[model samples]
Target: MSLRIGQLPDRTPVKLSVSVEPDLACALADYAAIYAETYGAQEKPETLVPVMLEMFLSSDAGFKRARKALHARASKGDT
Candidate 1:
């Protein structure tokens, strides 16, 4: 999808704010540095979080099944 996981084929914009503890914040900073080193581009780790999550969720079979079922029901006018 992206250079790593689900790298967003498009740059559709969404703004969100999240709260995390100091340790997690430090970890994310570390991750950002690593990601920059790996990808040869310096970008905030937070920028990758949503794509990472989407990729992770995409890889989850249970989520896929549930989403598929929900879609099917929606198409059939059954909530």
Candidate 2:
């Protein structure tokens, strides 16, 4: 089922933090930076986070395609 804006449940914001490996952190930063560069005019952090979340959550098709490509590359290397 598709989500409707009016059908969303009420929610409260909570603060959460997690640690990532240095390389992974760098990757995330790089992704955010590129997003800011392309879409961000002034490159505000406030705008960047929400947009990043939206992109991540909405990217099921992209993620599936990426996973398939990665598996193909790995299998090719194993042969």
Identify the candidate with maximal lDDT.
Answer: 1
How would you encode candidate 2's per-residue C-alpha lDDT over 1-79 as one tens digit per residue?
Answer: 6665566576776555667688866777777688668877555444455667768867888777887899998989952
lDDT of 2: 0.70
lDDT of each: 0.88, 0.70
Note each model's CA RMSD in angstroms: 7.8, 10.4
After superposing candidate 2 on the true structure, give the runs of residues whose Cα lies further than 4 Å from its correct spot: 1-8, 41-79
Which 10 consecutive positions of candidate 2 have the poorest summed lDDT? 41-50
CA shift at 41, candidate 2, in angstroms? 4.1
Error in Å for residue 5 of model 2 = 11
Could you give me the TM-score of model 2 versus the true structure?
Answer: 0.42
Compute each candidate's TM-score over C-alphas.
0.70, 0.42
